[model samples]
Target chain A: MSGHMEITLNGQTKNIPGNASLQALAEQYTKEPTRVVAELDGAIITRDAWSRTILKAGSKVELVSFVGGG
Target chain B: MPPIAHQTAQDSFELGGKIFSSRFLLGTGKFRNKGELKASILSSNARIVTVALRRIDLERHDENILEYIPDGVTLLTNTSGARTADEAIRIARLARASGQGDWIKVEVINDSKYLLPDNEETIKATKALTAEGFIVLPYISPDLYVARRLVEAGATAIMPLGSFIGSNMGLRTREFIQVLINEIRVPMIVDAGIGAPSHACEAMEIGAAAVLVNTAVAIADNPPMMAKAFAQAVEAGRAAYLSGLPAKRPQGEASSPLTGFLFE
Candidate 1:
């Protein structure tokens, strides 16, 4: 449990350290994580706090971006 | 006041403290490609363009739509997929976090068949977003009461639908929209279901602050050309409206007097 932790990111299960920062997880998932808005569980974690926001075990995270829409 | 033959640069529309000379708002969606999107926008001379928020596709990084948007043009991110107030609020915050400015087009549509905007959710999202310092432009179904509620909710502008979204059916709710235009003090933008340049012109002629067109221009045989036509049509309609349309006559009124016609 100390070495690896399981979290759901964008509904996909991933194993990272319990103390992994949100920034690390974002970078791992998308090339443009800076442009993404991350929501941890039900609350939004702003970009400035990504480095300090730690992912806990069984956390539900969602990353979204801007695309073409009318 | 009579409509001027020429509208100077001073004639501009202000939204959320921003002044825009062009009254046309473009939607950057459904283009065949990035090049086409850029060309159509430029041709239309629309200063404000709308985009949507979605989950980034990790596999298709090259398909990122933001790269295609040019500099100097303002981007209005729309909450097109949000079916509830919370979802739309989240999308608006995410859009602002992307450094795309605080302009948000709140669209909460739960109905799929008509693709109508949910006025109740839209009002909630508008109030929430605007309170957080975002400029909210809520797209509603062109109801007088709903529009007033949105304004009370601090919406910067009210974008009432002409008909179903992307239906290209023209202004099916023209009468209701006219009512909103007359009652609402803020800018009244006609969004969605505008199929042709004529439709856009009609909306403008009826005193719409602006018209947001997408499918008509994006899916045209020549998007850039269609965009140009729409731009011209919008201007013409606005000018005609300003010039004050001639009063209608119930009976047949001939250009020449009836007594002097053939008898002379």
Candidate 2:
């Protein structure tokens, strides 16, 4: 049985697997995973638990990537 | 014996009724990692650190950088991306709501390449923030006229850039900075483009009340060592200024008059 959850990545909302870890979700978006950090509900998610964490409905997810220019 | 410290020396400055002990203010960006950043901050002995606000990530367990900073240090939120007065006002309010301090670094970078402040927008924003009960420190060009305008707009202190943001060009606007030191009654903090301890010393020698440095210390090979160097430089500069430098002379003067002994 598959469960669906509503999540907002960055500012866009989408439906995804309820048990999907942040790292798995990130993998679906981009192949380069080192520069990005996941934030769940206004808090920064540590790298160690990005893969095992499950998503919930109406959760706000932001994928912050470090960009260097200046 | 340890060198005699200046009697009137103060580690902290009072702004808007709050006191800050460390004269060196720091920025949170550009560090290689959290550990290095923490170490650098400790070495700098900065009592206040600035951080920018953005959307929070809600997907995984987030690492709050605030948790890493020592509690004694005050957090100064900045509106780095705001280009106009309206946007700056909104960001300032939001930061005050989310952060613990009423102080905001009004950074309106309209031109991304130069990262210079829009003087008109900054003046407008400073007035608005002041009316809203916020201690406004406008990051502005090293122009004495612009600094005077900022003061008229009710800015708590004027943060003049030594060079463009993150450029590491030290004291390019030394002339204007000197003018500011002579004229501005409020504290003059030399912010940005300070790449070394010598640069910081130059600013202090010219009478800058304080200096905010980040990129130089944060991006160095050994950030902690750089921080310590900055700390010593700031102290040395302040001490020199307080000790009263000797007045400049046009020509060498004989300790004993050359003609006095010959006449006898």
Candidate 3:
């Protein structure tokens, strides 16, 4: 329990390793992390700062990318 | 020494301090394939393209929309899923964080039946986004009052719907859109409801600076060809407008002189 924690990701609850950074979470979902924008709670975390921004238990994260639209 | 004369340049589709020769603003949606989308964009020669931001499709990891768009094209991110000004603002900020340009099409719609834009909310979102130095384009009903308010709120362009979004209704509010084109100072990029190349042409013929389209081209049997057709129609319409389409006459006026006719 000490090495893992639950966090809300894209509106779904998920268990991630404890002390994981945003970059780590992003990599878990995408190989091209540079093409996404991460929103931690309500603030935008740019790709450059993702590696240093650590996630805490109960942290909410939303990773968004461009898609076809009108 | 001979005196030098300066030549002034004009850009027909200028928006957000950038000049684009093509008057077609294409939406990257509903394409059957990425290759066709890319081909359509290339054929249309649209300098400004729109994209929506959403959670990445985890299953389609092999494809990315951004990869389909070529370089040097401006991405005008649209807030499609937003139902309020605050939601639109949130989308705009996230789009900017992607390191793409700050051009956003603010679409605040609470209605589900028609997908008609809420004019008041669009104006509100435009004001907030423009203040943050984002090049905002607010989509709304073709109301003169709403247009004036949006322009005052710092919107770079006013995108009045020609009909309902994706309805392909073909300029149902033609007269209303003409009002904005005639009265509003900012560029009127007619958006939505355009279904055919001729529909896009009609909007341009009435003096629209540009038009954004998605459904017509995307749903065509051949998307790239259809995109080309729309692009050509837009250009032809612009040309007709520039050349001054003959004034409508209540009665017929013969092109040939009455006295010059040999049969007479």
Candidate 4:
């Protein structure tokens, strides 16, 4: 079903389209899609493969970006 | 142009197959604003700066740090939130996948209160990451054995804490870090607890290959100016180290004869 499904994103549960890909979720989160790294479950979804990696119900997603740090 | 005396010729800092001249590696965190961060970076003239990765805030939009960082500076992405070797490696991979360069600063800290790095986990991450063709710089607590192991794990450098991170306490671990500087083959870049330009100078004076400063510069009222001070201090200390510091003496040697006065 292409209806909304709940997935854990950056620790909070979010409802997204069941057919949404990792790419879509990342683009919706960050303006700079090139600098965003998305992980499905525990595996890193590389930029090239983000569009093809579909999200599932209850799938854990982590979106990370680099920031100022020492 | 006149050449400055005591300058070490061909002393380019070669790390991970890249060359950087400045020994002051700035940490780009805790800045009041992105403009200040950019100004500090330019004023510091730091060729290598450290950055950390974190989960993107889902609720609020924040400025992109990459836009502030000027081009040509090497980005040393740090694994700060990692509590284990595996977690650190995962962060490193994600950073690389995001087009951040391969230079990873392996920081595995399990302690919440003191925030001291876990040397064992750091070494494990270094070994794994280096084997994966990464240029790893592992942060540790300045143990001689641990440093040797990190180098053996193919670490490009070992960043021993001068003191606790962001303590502004300065080189409390001077003696231990000195041991690493003397023994470790890779560059011994003193990291953490460097509060002021003087601290950076002191670390360099003790033969430290480089130093990484964050909170000190970031918290300064005039960050860009403070960064320039740190840059100058690093250079001054490097000059003193290269010029061969004088030996300590128990007895004072008089510069002039005691009988040279008019009374004589």
The TM-score of the first chain in every model comes to 0.90, 0.83, 0.95, 0.93
Deviating ranges (above 4 Å) for candidate 3: B1-11, B59-62
Local accuracy of candidate 4 as per-residue lDDT tens digits, B1-264:
887754655667788898887888999999999899999999999989999999999988778999998999999999999999999999999989988789999999999888999999999999999999999999999999999898889999999999999899999999999998888789899999999899999999999988899999999999999999998999999889888899889999987987869976
Between the candidate structures 2 and 4, which one is better when assessed by TM-score? 4
Give the whole-model CA lDDT for all candidates, comma-separated.
Answer: 0.88, 0.78, 0.91, 0.91
Residue clash pairs of candidate 1: none
Model 2 chain B weakest lDDT span, ten residues long: B54-63
Q: On residues B1-264, what C-alpha lDDT tens digit does candidate 1 reach at each position?
A: 987555645567888888887888889888888799888888888889999988766445636677777787889999988999999998888788778899999999898898888889898899888899999999998888989888898998899999888899999999999999899998999999999999999999999999999988889999999988998899999988887988888998778756855657
List, residue by residue over A7-52, the lDDT tens digit for candidate 1.
Answer: 9887888889779999998898788777788889978888899999
Runs with alpha carbons beyond 4 Å of true place in candidate 4:
B1-9, B257-261
Across residues A1-70, which tens digit of lDDT does each residue of candidate 4 receive?
Answer: 4599999999999999988999899889888878788888898888899889999899999998989999
TM-score ranking, best first? 4, 3, 1, 2
DockQ of all candidates, in order? 0.67, 0.09, 0.85, 0.88
Stretches of model 1 off by over 4 angstroms after superposition: B1-5, B256-263
lDDT of 3 by residue, B187-258 (tens): 999999999989999999999999999999999999999999999999889878877898898998988777
- Rate residue A26 of model 3 by lDDT: 92
TM-score per candidate, chains pooled: 0.92, 0.76, 0.95, 0.96
